[model samples]
Target: MNVLCSESMKIEEEVSDDSGTAAVHSLPTELLVLIFSWLSVEDLALNVSKVCQRWKDSLYFRTLWCDKELIYENSREDLFIFVLSVAPALKQLSLNPLFCGDPAAIVNAICKGPKDIRKVHYNLSLFPAAVASRILGHYKKYVCELHLEGYANKHSSIYRNLDAELGQMSQLRSLKLSGYFDTKWDKKVLERGCLNLHHLDVSLIQDESDSYKPFLDNVKSHLKTLKLPQFKSNVGVLELVSSCTELKEITLCLDDLRCISTLQSLESLHIRWSDGVLKSKMNRFVRDCPVFGNLKELTLFYIPGLLATAIAKQCNKLETLNLHGITSCANIIKSVPSLQKLCIVDRLSLRMRHIQKLPRYIPNLRHLNVLGSFLNKGIPPKIISQLKQELPELVISSEPFVRYTKRGNKGYFTKCTDSSTDCSSDEA
Candidate 1:
């Protein structure tokens, strides 16, 4: 009876092992489909395709090919061919037209597919409008967001026509056009107006007489955010803010200090200027313009001298302030009392000498981002300890040490031993 029992136990063990193997081999098809959907197009072709016939069969699902952002090169024709075969429901598409061997033909083929394309981004310079128009006419039902970059003067007419067609798409909510512009074409589109536009970004070419006033006036009612690079004049910016009651954010890449006072309702302001330019304009803006009283965030790049002081003194309500590539911002650091966050980037020569001087003015600062040369030496232990003591929540990132410690926490100052070094050693 014992021998018979042992033989039965052996049989049962073997049967259990086989059952486990079978279960492992038979994974649910739905799970496999889900796994493949997460893979990128290139990875799917290279790795997933080698899995087996089951994966290849699962790849046939049209959902896998619906939305794609691809950069085509001559050597990757096989990948493109595979994508064309697999993805049929393509919606949003972005690509570098120059990289494709025959961009016009390839675009036509892709747009011809029965995909519900709603948004498209491309290098406008290389795009052939004849093909684009055809694609748009067919897929106009759901098309909305359009982003065109790298445009030049010659293509202004093309962009105008494209804008006209885009205006027809009732669903279009955002349009970003970057590159050179034609004065006449821009005026035409601005006059016609984009009824559904909520977000618009236009990069002005070197030509100053682009009549931006009309464009600003037209979109002033519906425009939510405006970003202008190298805008030298205050007239256009002032008009834009006064007219666009709904405007929430404005980013100006102007060097003129005079224009800073013109921004009234701007909640967020980003200014990029050289040391001299920043000093002149920032001082004027801080001392003369009270428009920044309501500002929540302010970003300064390469600003020096008394300008930083002016900003800190005037923009008292600013919650976040970012100083980058500034050599002399110590005065500003001493005045901002309500500042909650401070970010310093790529100006080690400036920050190493000036950062410690900041605690007295911005006592309530919670977050700090220190990058570039300053981070190389790591945060001074004394400074870290002082920060922990003053600010309840502190984050410091340096090369040798990246730490987060709360106020009154023990071992917060163990990293840096010298707490008595006078901040006076830091130069102005």
Candidate 2:
């Protein structure tokens, strides 16, 4: 009681010299704190905190600083440290590699931060061994997701302690390691520590070798998603993939469709930078397996045209489809009638006439993102504007090619995709 009284007295003394009180002072402290909670760190420091002693003291309120996520980027070390000191209830923290401050200070600040932080994304290899150990030790129990970047090798023993530290994180569910990691990673440690780990992303690692087999073997039954490098056919990888009964989402090259066919529980598939597969094989694979029947999302990047069309026909429940660097998408789009979101990127030679047929192909599409060099190929902005006018209810974003005007209050009309005719006038 004395502490509360003394604190209130200090605030009163600080404001006693001021003659006139602002109308904002009429609001209760709780209400003021609630209002201030909506403000950013910079706003609080440079604007509201300078308003008065009363407002400044309100900044110290525990409830006011309980932000769920914090991303440190281009902020001063002192200010960043100040924010970290007050923000004890942070659930996630992302330290950008481009952070313009003393790395040691920020790292130390994180060491002293809230122990219950669930997600941490930072490069632990930048710090000394002791500092890194302190951070790993502090967040072992609380962190469920980690995006760590560091140096490790399969042949030599560099950052081997990192493997040991990773083993201590028993609650880890998702891990994305981007560095020079190799097969020397202690699979037994991960298998023992991260039993619930369902998502693993090693796609960004410099070492393109199939070092993911160890991780796959460890958490195959629990894994729900795997983002790996290019597809490499091997007996061990094939066997490990087949055993992943709970796997749902996988991002890899479509070089080996046979390995993917075995994943009956797969819900999402991303084929990145792959070609040279026969159309007959893709058609037969889709015909033989239930891969597309259960899929919700599909991303085709530099893959065969028939593979996309074949899969699209079976994806009755697909919600999202991303076609990147693929020109022949008319058949693929028409096949997925249930698609809600469609993203097309880098269609260099895509004609404006083909784009006008979006509504005719996918009537159910709620969101459409058409971005790439296609807009630069002598295409006018009026075509997209006409699309907006035709389907006022449908959301469209065409960036880097044509800028969309901010939507205004307009009467909703029946979408052309809902019409019986093909709508191939091209009057716009």
Candidate 3:
């Protein structure tokens, strides 16, 4: 604590030199802009912008704001308008529902501004659907990513307007819809909208109808990644998936694997928590497809020991594996001979024997990440020392919870003790 205070004092002294001859002030504008980019948007608005005329002017550097994500949350409406006018290169915008003022006004402001935005995240419940539709139409030529959160009932007019406008977004590449949407009423519109999408996430929708078939069929030839709501015995959906020859990654319940086994291009697969499929199905899939030779990444929430061993036997070239609720690691280690990274989460039964045997089982492993409730103890320092000695090239990290934050112009992880705070998985 004292060290941190001393460092802060030094930074304050360097920043507020009375003679105005601080070395930092002499840095080039490009270097100064790079330094300010390390700070958060709030810090830029409330702290650095008030520093001096030169620093204030540096904020206008186009590269500084191009990739910055502007999210409207508790900040003033006029401030958003100011940012929208100045940060013309901003590529992503997220309008939060908690904003005190009207969200439509901000959307209106964006429509009149530059069309450089490529991604938008909006909530239908926060504003009128007509306004949302108009904004979509205005930016259809440039916007490539759209994430819409819906709370409308089956009969709401919001779906009708959104569906009609979505069809015109020719540049759309990614679409994610959550909550309730009128899938049946928007079937034709979705087919047109989804024809060019490479990534689709509908895992949070509450519909169980075949409306997904049209969306899937339109993009079957080029879809690369898909996140489905749940794995069901819908033969129509399965048949469509079987024809998605270009699919490279998917997240769904591993209930039936026959359809996906034919995806020779599949590089990654994630089995959701709800997958309670029988082991017989898994064995048959592994036996038939020989463990998807092209598969490089696998995420398993839980699987029987026999099934895990059988799957491992065929995963000789798997590069990354995420295991949750796994009690034993022997069966998993044997198959991934080419594994480079492993993440084990929420398992308490990880023993020292398993840790010591990792190098022998997976000789090419380069990184090991262990996350669980006993994070405070981490891998006992003694075991870590021994493992380091055995595998000097390997990198290891332990954490109780995964969260990211920026500190002193650099990224680092911090433990989360409070439940109210949100933990960002992405790096700051």
Candidate 4:
């Protein structure tokens, strides 16, 4: 009887092991990072990391530790140092004046702890030029992403040393600056150094002169992604942008449709329209503008008129569309059929009917950011519920409130992908 029972138990164990679901441990590292990314950093550290040893290791190593604000929230330098030590696999680290008074000390501590710093962020204006140089000098080889930010604080101002130090970091793939109007430092960095940089975000102080035209001309051929500052230009920066033939993505205004005609390799475009932009120019662009079949992503905020329809009709390959400040449901449903992700904020014409009709038009749509409300009126629960039920595969959610790095003269939105869609950093 004992022999028979033992044999039966062994057989049951074998069957369970063979037929059961795959173990969570077998999941790919990239996929696991994607899953844990859904949780907040507080929840991740306090809750998720305590689950198991494997969970702790995975969280620490695979995940990219961002959110410099969290360091301030904790208010402990030793704790930040501990994080830098354990997360040797850190992909990026951003340090600002909010965290520490001395930028040099912060960089020294981080460099001593982690050697694999892939991206580093600091505002030159926050630190003395020598200290800023020391910070960049530490990550000269490993840092591929550098944001030598500019701040308009009374305590900090940009200097030539900041630009000179940046030119030494040859491995930089992405870079952002406030504006080169202060000196010829802009020309010095790109012309004399940092040859590998492909992405550049520049924000001008005011709408007075085209001081950045020379910098744009210098980087026209080598640069692939460019974000110009937010200046009220009726003519748009098309004249300067036309020279950048290698540009894959751009965010600028368009008072004249003819500006887009010269961009052959353009993939993603964001058009910012203020109150006074001529509707006649937009209409003419829609009617006469050449078909941008390669363009896959487009964003238009506060743009007037029926231009979205015209754009969607023309750019048949458009897969991602972000529109805010007065948009059309009929135009979206009838046109951009290839759209996979759509962001619509505070739509004047968005109704339950449009929500219902949305699925039929864009069957392949997988992500929807239906955010913002009309005055005090919130989005109806029933509409959100229906969307979930009908589009089972779609990941639908409201937008999170974004807290920016609090700088004046910010020009463009920042969104960068490995191969698609370029994002911009804040202006100096």
TM-scores for all candidates?
0.73, 0.75, 0.81, 0.67
Q: How accurate is candidate 4 locally (lDDT)?
A: 0.62
Give all candidate RMSDs, comma-separated: 10.3, 8.6, 9.3, 12.7
- Candidate 1, residue 368: Cα displacement in angstroms equals 1.4
Per-residue alpha-carbon lDDT of model 2 for 323-422, expressed as tens digits?
Answer: 9877677778888888888888755645677768877877777777765646533235466566757666566655433333544469444312222212
Q: What would the TM-score be for candidate 1 when compared with the true structure?
A: 0.73
lDDT of 4 by residue, 257-352 (tens): 456678888898887774666677767767766636778998877765476666667878889988777566567556888988988776466665
Best by TM-score: 3
Model 4 bad stretches (over 4 Å): 1-75, 81-87, 98-107, 153-157, 178-181, 186-189, 203-212, 233-237, 256-258, 373-395, 398-428
Predict model 2's lDDT versus the native.
0.71
Off by over 4 Å in 1: 1-26, 29-38, 57-68, 88-92, 113-119, 136-145, 151-157, 186-194, 203-214, 231-238, 255-264, 274-285, 351-360, 375-377, 380-392, 397-428
Question: Which of candidates 1 and 4 is the stronger one according to lDDT?
Answer: 4
Q: 112 in model 1: Cα distance from truth in Å?
A: 3.3
Error of 3 at 212 (Å): 2.9
Clashing pairs in 3: none
lDDT of 3 at 12: 26
Model 1 alpha-carbon miss at residue 272, Å: 1.7
- How much is the lDDT of residue 402 in candidate 2? 35
Q: Residue 387 of candidate 3: its Cα lDDT?
A: 64
In model 4, how many backbone clashes occur?
A: 6
lDDT of 3 by residue, 128-225 (tens): 66776776777788889999877744246556556567667778889898777654535666665634789988878776656556767777787999
